[model samples]
Target chain A: MWSRSNTISMIFVALATTLVCLYARGWGYTIVQHIGISTDFTDITISAAIILSGGLAMLCGADLPVVLIIGTLGVFVSLTLAQDALVRYLSLAAVLFSIGVYGMVVSRNAVRVLMSIELMLNAVNINLVAFARYVDPNLIRGQLFAIFILTVAAAEAAVGLAIVLAVYRNMSTVDMERFNLLKW
Target chain B: MGENLTALTAWAQNHSETTAFYILAFLAIPFAYGVLLDRRIIRSGFLLIGVFGAISGVFLLLQAQFLAMAQIMIYAVGITLVVVIALMLTNPRLEHDVNPAIPVAKTSGIVVSILLFVTIYLSLRSEIWPLSPSPVKADNVLQIGTGLLTYYSLPFEFASVLLLVALIGAIMLARAEHRPPSQMEERLDAQEDLSSERNDNVVQV
Candidate 1:
């Protein structure tokens, strides 16, 4: 359904976002002296915004479910934008983790499964780092756990890819349906 | 000019974290969805890198600078291997792209993910976090290094050993020769013949 121009533009948009994030000099100074920014929009508000905005996007004929996957994430009004809450970070992590779970279950490709597992692990890492920053920043106990998870995830990825390659060598196919050796 | 500058700085200070988070999360979700559902398997591998990079941005937003760098470094290496493996296993030149054909997995996967998201989000909503009054120190890298070497040294050592073991194990597994399906079938046939001979002997006895 994506035209060439549309696809190229999407890539550009993603690149622009990545650049802005990587190069932004100001990393959200608290500036509690200047202004104390807070938001009245809580969890309920965000949830409602996602559903309503996503439904409207679907109505506007952007793709069906993939539009819903992210259409609302970037829609926060500037007034409601800067809610410095632990739950905000935690919620993003949850969304990523859920998508990873879906990938792991639905993908017939073994490599996709491994990628999904990595995604899930990164989700956990986000939670750890969020806790480190918000709850125990001085001690950084959560960052410690995040490091371990990263290590294990790397090891697991390496091993999982090797196993997939090995299986592919023998079977000459990477389809999950074909790898039915243990299936009774 | 000074007034204008202060206004811009104030606005930036107020909105930067949430703006960064939203942008990265926006990038991440679609790429993740692509990783799961893209027809081209190799493309999915590439999308995985996008997802990783965005999450690393999230890490940076949280002020875990060291972990953010580590996220990029580690996932860079890991995702490279994954892409290589995808190339080795799949032929994008073939007529049929790799798509999930299982109707059951499709429906059930969506249902399960929705369930998981709801459970986790609802659970998180009910809980109150103990917020720290103190701001996070700027010297996070130093703290992490000291903690790893001092308090968490044992686990740190254990992680290194685990990495080494995984390295050797992956090499061994990938390097091992694969028995062809024909040879495997031959071996199975030979086993069947032996069992049949044993059955005859039992019948005679």
Candidate 2:
């Protein structure tokens, strides 16, 4: 249920968010300073900009679907651009991990849940590699850890899918809600 | 004002890598969302591949060439394809997309996910990370190989064993149920055997 005008409005909102984040350079840093965390304010700035855009879109009567799309895109773009380069990478990883969490929680299908879990693992891998790149580039301990995670993730996927198959054969349904056999 | 504009333009031009990062992030996050939120599970399976492929590109950007190749090989090409096949085998009739989650559970799920994310984000922003300034050497693959076979050899061996066990377990679990024939089919077999015996007698006669 998306109209052309709504889509246009959403793009406008996203563009507006980009402009704000790009120009409000030290706003993120200031937020971090107040928080007393050595980390940057990239995450908050992006979240605020996207939330602001969404509110603006609603005020302008942008449809719900358009607003959602714009908000997501705005978050995506700002996530990559926030903070310094190394910190920006970490922020992106955080955003991804959050998305994975949302998926794992909300998905009804068991296999979809597994996919979400993989997404979460990949997000962790991103963080590891980012740290490896920016912090310990010489040793690459982070990359090595990432390799181990990859191995573990592969093993987990195999075991998980096998269990899913067994459950499907027994119950004829892969819905997460239907898996209450273990519940007291 | 003119000087500020010029400085901003120059800074933007110098940060071309950031532009690439933005492009890859755009490619990855939406597809990852599709994997979870798409009503059609089959489409989600395909979208998972897209997400992995983009993540592999991100790995390359981070200078983890070996990890990037492995990501593409193991995740993009291997695991996702397996997932898609499993989805097809499990749900051949497309009868799945209809069951919406109860609103209460759905809302709780969203709340929990948001809480977890907020916690992680806050911690990441607040933590003081130990950072090194040295660049990664050119012979990353060699160093990794040496480390894997030497200092990390125990874990490497364990990982292989784990893979072997998982492969065997998956094969055993996914094998078709060993069901016997029904009574009607058994009776039909008997009748066919009797008819064949009588035909043989006639031929002998």
Candidate 3:
């Protein structure tokens, strides 16, 4: 399957799941705050419905592509359902990390591999922000740390890509198993 | 007893249950998945994310926001990125084949990992975590900045220099040189006689 289509479908599913979870959790205000959308509902009743639908979709022996899309969507929905900022942040981080791991383990493209790592980094940044909110409501140290991490990540990416380029020049291919020059 | 109960009730009222539930779920689900899954990458990634997420939550609950942020940024983001990038540089292909001859080694690795997990779990369970006497002050950022500039200035400068040196080394190693290798041609020439002899043997056979 073309990854482009898969990415789009995954994003759609995530949006739908978030909507369902918000409806179910009776926390319409939370979603409203996140997307700047206003809605009136003291207690929404859509969480159970979405969970059932999602579970059924998973159990239908769907294609791997479909399952991956739904799984990613489910993660997003679950995270957004969280009511507290800290929980929401952690959930977002978890989803990002899991997606990154999936991409790292499944995709063969170098760019995809790098993207997965970036996703994981973003998850950590979210966690940092949440934690900072918890510890000191006034301090922005968490944001600073996140910036530092981003800087380091950028440096690492540069060095890593350079190495990959060098390896490609020498071998004409990036197949890992072929790099056996140092095995002894 | 009445006073203690009132205090407990006040604490519970101030805190959000949704946060606690999410944290617990995140921590438990990954561990369960790790135990049930056969794939190492899946298991490891899930476990790491769960553990880190839980720690971050605890940090938030404990009011050590800066430390928690550092934990997530440094340990979760930095380390995971390094590992994933390393994986990418080495193998872009997601090959699932395992060497049949490495069963014993694989088993040993699994055993060791399980043992380490158990040890850590036990220690965590036994530890007595104390709540902060007072909520963290709002000026933690300023304090951290002051500490970094005053007490940690030398180490910070050294770390920067070390990073620069590493950057230079990485660039040097990765830079492509157009010049022909001096020894490679000589080595190929030396192997020519062996190739010719093998060709002769094949013809004679």
Best by DockQ: 1
Question: How much TM-score does chain B earn in each model?
Answer: 0.75, 0.80, 0.51
Q: Which runs in model 1 stand beyond 4 Å of their true positions? A: A1-65, A71-84, B1-13, B92-98, B178-205
Q: Write the per-residue lDDT of candidate 2 for residues B1-205, one digit (tens) a residue.
A: 7997898778868977786787888788778776766778888889999999999989888889999999999999889978888888677333343643444565566557556756865676567777777778889888889889998999989989988998898888888666567865776688679658756866676
Ranked by DockQ from best down, the candidates are 1, 2, 3
Off by more than 4 A, model 2: A1-46, A52-69, A76-82, B1-12, B95-102, B183-205
TM-score of each: 0.73, 0.80, 0.46
Evaluate every candidate with DockQ and list the scores.
0.54, 0.51, 0.07
Winning candidate number (lDDT): 2
**Residue clash pairs of candidate 3:** A24-A47
User: Which run of 10 residues does model 2 chain B get worst, by summed lDDT?
Assistant: B92-101
Tens digit per residue, CA lDDT, model 3, A1-184: 5555455446446655666555544566665556554443222223333334444544543333443444434443443453444444465456545545554544333433454565567557666665555544454466556646655665666566566667755664554446565788
Q: How much does candidate 1 score in TM-score?
A: 0.73
* Model 1 chain B worst lDDT run, 10 consecutive residues: B92-101
- Candidate 3 segments whose C-alpha is farther than 4 A from its true place: A1-67, A79-82, A138-144, A176-184, B1-147, B178-205
Compose the digit string of candidate 3's lDDT tens values, residues B9-72. 6855776655474445446344423322323333343345454556566555645566667767
State interface RMSD in Å for all models.
1.5, 1.7, 8.7
List per-prediction Cα lDDT, in the order shown: 0.71, 0.76, 0.51
lDDT of 1 by residue, A1-184 (tens): 6665455445433533333332232222332123443323233333444455445544454444454354324332211234446887887888889888888887777777888888899999999999998899899999999999988988898888888878876675677777986779
